[model samples]
Structure formats: C-alpha cells, structure tokens
Target chain A: MIKVSILGTGNVATHLFKAFSKSDEIEIIQVIGRNKKALLAFAPENKTTSDFSDLKESDVYIIALSDNYIKTVSEQLTIENKLIVHTSGSTPMNELSHHQRHGVFYPLQTFSKSNELDFKKVPICLEAKSKEDLALLKNLANLVSENVYEIHTEQRKSLHLAAVFVNNFTNHLYHLGSEICEENNVPFQILSPLIQETARKIETLSPYEAQTGPARRNDSNTITNQLEQIKKPELKAVYELLSKSIQATYGKEL
Target chain B: MIKVSILGTGNVATHLFKAFSKSDEIEIIQVIGRNKKALLAFAPENKTTSDFSDLKESDVYIIALSDNYIKTVSEQLTIENKLIVHTSGSTPMNELSHHQRHGVFYPLQTFSKSNELDFKKVPICLEAKSKEDLALLKNLANLVSENVYEIHTEQRKSLHLAAVFVNNFTNHLYHLGSEICEENNVPFQILSPLIQETARKIETLSPYEAQTGPARRNDSNTITNQLEQIKKPELKAVYELLSKSIQATYGKEL
Candidate 1:
C-alpha cells in the first residue's frame, strides 16, 4: 500500500481526506494541522498529528492548506527525499522544489463538506517534476476519478481563473437575483427554474452564442429602463460594469 | 382562436411567434417589421407586412419592439379598443394602457432565434389592466406553457432585474473566462465541466449557502495570487469587483 500524510484540515483538505481514506490501496499515515480540534475532527481512524516531523515516514506528504501557507509549511517538512504535492491549481508545483519529488493533484470542482462529491467524474489535473512522480500522481488520481489530464502549471493557473468566473462569479450573480426577489416580496424560488435553465444551456452552446439581453440586442432604451429598475447601489455598479463588458465583447452596446 | 399580430421580428418576437403558432388556440395573423428580409426569414404561414396599421385586424396586437419604440408603435396603431400587449419585462403594462384592453406576455427565458424553445417550461409572467384582459393573458400563456403566473407590473420589473444578474451577468463572466483562456493558450472547454457542476449544485442549494472560494474563506493571499495570475485588464477588474462583492456579502475579504 502507498503510505500518505496530508497537511491541513480546511475545505480542500477535508474533502481530499474523505475521498482518499475510502481507498484500499492508500494508507493515510498522518493528518496534520495547527488547530488541534480541527485536526482531530478531520483525522480518520488511522493517525493524526499537528507536527510535520511526525510525517517523515510516509511516501508522500500532501499540503492542502491555503496558497499563502503552503510555502511556509513546505519549508518546515522533515521529509526531504519523499514526494511532496499541493492541491492548488494556481500554486506552482515547483513551490516544493526543496523536496526531491514535487507534484500537484488538483480536483477542478467546487467542494463543500455537506455537498456530496462524485470524485469518479470530477476532472483531476495532474503535474509533477519527474515521470515516476507523475505516474504516481496519475495513479492516485485514477483511484478517485475517471477524468485525469496532464495540465502544465501555467495552464492550471489560467484554468483556476476560469473556475473563479464560472463558479465564484456566477454564484454571486445568483445571490444578486435572490436579493432582488427579497426586495420585491417575490419568492426567490420563482427564479430557480430560469437559473437552472441558463446553466444547463451551456452544456450544448458557448456562453457567447447563448448571450441575450439589452446589450446583445443593442436596445439602448431597454438598457436604460432596466438600469432605472435596479435600486441597489452595489447592484447598479455591477450592472453597469457587466454592460460595458458585454458591449466591448460584441460591439453591440447602444 | 385568438388572432395575434407581432410588431417586430427580433429574438423575442421570433420565439413567441413560433411558440404561439404551434398552439392550436392562437393564430399568428400577421407579422410586421421594417426589415422585409428579416420578416421573410421568420417563415410564418400567415401574412407578413411592414405597416403598423395592417395590425388592426388581429384580436390581439403584440408589440415586441424595444422599450423606446413601444409607445411610438402603440400610437401608430389605427385600431382602438383592440387588445394590445407588449412582450417586455421592464416596460410597464400601462405603456399600452391607451387601449381599453392592455396586457403583457413576458416569457421568462433567455431566447435566441436559432435556439428552439420548449415554451411548456418557460415561466410566462402575465399582467393586464382589467380582470377580463388578465384572464385572456393567462389563457394565452397557458396555451404555450404549463407554468403561468399573474404577476403585477412592479413585481415583473423586479424579476427582470433579477434576470439581468443570472442570465446576463453570469454570461459576461463566462465571456471573461473564455478571454482569459484564449490569452493564456489554455483550452476554454476544460472549464465546461466545472461550470456545469457549479450550476447543477444550486438545484438543491441556495446561492448564498452554496458560495465557496478564497473570498469566502477570507484567504487574501490566494486572492492576491489570483490577481497576479490574471493578465487581462478587464478580467482583473471583474475579479476585483466580484471579490469585493463576495467580501461585502460575507462581511470580510479573502
């Protein structure tokens, strides 16, 4: 069995731990974190520790902390010759160059503790410093997912940015819609079907081709009326900025 | 049959024309548009004309023009006391109140001429000046869709604003993502699965409850790293604005 230790007990850390712990080919030797309580809660039935020195015996040590903390944590690891990997798409896999083997195992999906994840289907982006380590990363990823791609660190960085748009920015817009419904005393549920349809449509069409509205139509009058309808200060700013963007892309703004 | 005449051959008009024509209860009597080329392409089995006065014979004259042109088109119509409706979400139903029987038939779906619509599922918001006309509008919507609601003009205006967020702004972010990918030599299609998953997750969760990312965790280092990774000027602006919005909603920045 491949022995592994994971550092950090945050969202990414938690999800990865749960996913990997279920496998028979992998043995989680240690789960490390600064917060004793969080670490205890996140640690599986095998082992738990708050110190990196306690993880030297494992074949691989996975850093699942925030990007800012990864550099510091990597510097403190006691295992120098073992493979070290981080689960960040934007953070370069070379950040752990201090180690003999370095890699990245990034699952390109938004995760939450309560939300059930289908790792078998989520795309796992893999990268490593050497062929042997790359093979190991791919093997580990294959155990958890069906879609594994060899993405370079630079490509992964941009894919992460794209993720921010589709997942983070899109969800913020949903929040805005719910807020508007609240102000109008309409059930936010009323907009749920339309919201689902918008996302579902992209499965078959490009976002640019799916685009519709005042900016697409170049209907300056409808744009003016809709702008007038928006009462929130922050929402109005969002509307104006997005409008300028749409117009810039299509050159259809009035 | 409720004889209907459409006053524009734009995205909304073309969609509604095809949808209503499919229903045996509604007859598309004529189609009026300034561009004969566009009108001819609509391929309606009924008469097609460019004159607004030619709309007089239909039982219901539907003005699916832009907001600035709705009043002008209504004024140009020679028929008095004929049931007149405008297919606009932002424009007030009263804009057509000059007629004795005025109403609205706002289909709450993002439409494109090439994208065939399943009107049976689209939420059709109806509003009219009188109970009789309101009943007529509801019946008309029911003919095309299973989901029909008698929403007030004010509430429909609010719903339209909400759509600007989910449909328009969400799509703008998608555009931004594609631009970022194209500039970085990364395949934009790689992000498609993530986008689909983000949207699918919301079917069971509220956007506020489903929110995730560096911004939600208050991990500013990652946010700063993402800002540095972003090369496009407009995308950086979008990232900053959306990050700020997330922070504002959560009462902290990452």
Candidate 2:
C-alpha cells in the first residue's frame, strides 16, 4: 500500500484525506497543519500534527496548501529523499524543488466542505521530476480517481488559468444572475436548470457549437434591451464586454 | 384535451413540440412555419402548414418565433378570441396585445436541437392578460412541465436578463476555457468536472456563498499570475474586468 501524508487543512487537503481513506491501496500516515483547531477534523482517526519539522515517514507527502503558502510550507518539511508534491494549478512543480524529488498532484475540481465528492470522476493532474516518481504518483492517483494526466508545469499553468475562467468566472456570472433575480423579486432557483444544462451541453457539443443566445446570434435589438435593463454599471460593462467577445468569436467563424 | 398549435420551427418550437407530443392531455393540432423545409421534422407526425392564413383551429396558439418576429407572426393570425401566447423571455406579454386574448408561455431554459431535455424539469414561466387566460396557459404548461411559475412581464424581463448572465454569458466563459485548453494541449474535458461542480454548488449554497478562487479570495498574486498567462488582449481584458467585478462584490461584503 502507498503511504501518504497530507499537509494543510483546507478543502483540498480534507478532500484528499477522505479520498485516500477510501482506497484500499493507500494508507494515511499523517496529516500536518499549522492550525491546531483546523486539524481536529482529521485528528480523530489518523495522526495529526501542527509541527511541519516532525512529519511522519510516508512514501509521498501531498502539500494541499494555498498558492502563496505552498513554497513556504514545502521549505519547512525537513524530510529527505521522499517524494513531495503540491496540489496547486498555478504553482509549478518546482515550487518543491528544494527536495530531491518534487511533483504536482493537482485535482482539477472545486471542493466544498458541505458537498460529498466522488473522487473517481475528478481529474487528477500529476507531474514529477523522474519517470519513477511519475509512475508512483500515477499509481496513487489511480487509486482515488480514474481520470489522471501527466501534465507538465507549463500545461498545468495553462490548465489553472483556464480553470479560473470556467469555474471562478462562471460562478461570478451566476452571482450576477442571482442579484438580478433578487432585485426583481424572482427566486434564483428559476435559473438552476438552465445553469445545469449549460454545463451539460459541453459534454456532447464543443462550447463553440453549444453556444446560443442574443450575443451568439448578434440580435442587436435584444442586446440593446438587455443592456438597458442592467442598472448596475459593472454588470452593464460585463454584459457589454462579454457580448462583444461572443460576437467577435462567432463573427470570425462566419 | 387542451388543443395547442405551435408557431415557428426554431429550437424552442421544436423542443416544445417534442415535449407536448409526450403529454396525453395536450394535442398539438398543427405546427406552423414560414420555412417549409424546417417544418418537415414535424410534418410526418402532425399537420404542418406554411401558409399563415391556413391555420388550424386550436384552443391555444404558441408563437415560438424570434423576439422580433413574435408580433408580426401574431398579427398574421386571423383567428380572434384565441389564447395567443409567445414563448419569449425578453419580449413583453403586451407584444401580443393586438389579439383579444394574449399571454406568455416562456420556458426558462436554453433549448438545443442536439440535446434531449427532461421537459418535467424545465421551468415554464406563464403570464396572461386575464385570469381565465392565465389559468389556460398554466394548464397547458402543467401538461409538459412540473415546474411552473406565474411570472408577469416585468418580472420575466428581469428573469430573461438574469438568464442571459447565467446561461448565455456562462456558456461564453466555457468557450473561453476551451480555447485556453486547446492552446495548452490540455484536453478541455479536464475542466468538465470543475465546471459541473461549480454549477452544482449553487443548488445547496447561494452563488455568493459558493464563490471561490483568486478573485473571491482577493489573491493578488494568483490573479496577477493569471492575467500574465492570458496572452490575448481581449481575453486579458475579460479576465481583468471580471476579476475586478468579483473583488468589488466581495469587497463590499467586508
């Protein structure tokens, strides 16, 4: 069985801990976090510690920390000759380069404390310095998820950026929709099915082909009406800019 | 049985036709369209006509045409004192006021010819000029969909505007993500789980509570890194503006 220790007590770390706990091929050696209170969630069944220097012996140490804390926390790990990986999309694998073996084990999904995620479907992006390390990471990743890819630092960087657009920015648009619904005394649930269908469409059709609306059609009359309806300046600007972008993207296709 | 005639042969019209076909309580007497070729899909199973004057007798007429064409199409119908409703989000119910009996039967979801939708889950927003007309439209809406709302013109205008943000604009964001994935040689499917999770999160949490990422956290380091990674001027602008909007939104909360 592959022995693993997870660092950080954030959503990603907690999720990885839970996912590894389910796999027969993996063993949770320890969970390290600076926040003693935050570590309580993982302390019950496994060894948990706030001291980074006194980490347990594990085959792989997964640092599931924030982007800024990744390098700092990796530097604190006094362990030697063991594989060290950070679960970050934007941060390169070399962020753990202080160690002899470094890699990236980023899960390309948003994690929520309240939600139960099926890790099997979550795509795990792996990167390592050596082929042996890569294979080891892949083996551990396969235990928890079926979708695994050996994405290098450059590709992972692009993936992270792309994710920000699709996940972070898309959620923001949902927020804007909710705000508009609230102002009009309409329940935000009215748009739930639409949101689900929008995501589902990309499964069968390319986002380019799946696209439809006033912007895609360049229906100037509806566009103008929508613009007039949006009272907030920021929302209006976003509406104008995105509408223009959609028109430009499809305009090129024709 | 509630007799209904569907006007136009667009995505909405065809989807409604398919939905009504499954319901035993709703009889689709005729499918009307100006384009003979487009009407062929429905011609095999039901009466299809191109001539506007040669319309069949039905309890209700559904004008599922483009926003601009709704009025013109309704005006062409010589039948009087019939429930003539338009399936449009932005077009006000009064757009069909020329008819003695006018209403709105808008489905609040994006319709695609390629996708098979569960009509029961689709939210059908109904509005009418009179109580009797409203009851008639609600009855027809209930025949196909389980989720029905009595949304007036002003409320529907906002709902449509909100939908543009959540559905249309959100799909555009997906397109942008796909472009980034292509450029980096990363399969767009990697982000699919993330996209789905983002949408699913709103079911349990409000969009404000569900929001996460660099902009939500105001992580300047990651935000700056992402901005630098985006090469195109237009995409860069979108990233910046959206990031700013997200920050502005959360900033007020603090």
For all candidates, state DockQ relative to the true structure: 0.61, 0.94
RMSD in angstroms, all models?
A: 3.5, 1.2
Q: What is the per-residue lDDT of model 2 for residues A195-230, given as tens digits with 9 covering 90 to 100?
A: 999999899999999888899998999999888888
lDDT of 1 by residue, B121-189 (tens): 888888888889888777778888888888888999899889888888888788788877888787777
lDDT of 2 by residue, B1-254 (tens): 99999999999999999999899999889998989888999956459988889888999999999888988888878998899999999889998988989999999988888799898999999999999999998888988999999998999999999999999999999999999999989999999999998999899999999889999998998888788888999999999999999999999888
TM of chain B vs. native, candidate 1? 0.93
Q: After superposition, how far is residue A99 of candidate 1 from its true place, in Å?
A: 2.2
- How does the DockQ of candidate 1 come out? 0.61
TM-score of each: 0.86, 0.98
Looking at model 1, residue A245 earns an lDDT score of 81
* Candidate 1 interface RMSD after superposing interface residues: 1.3
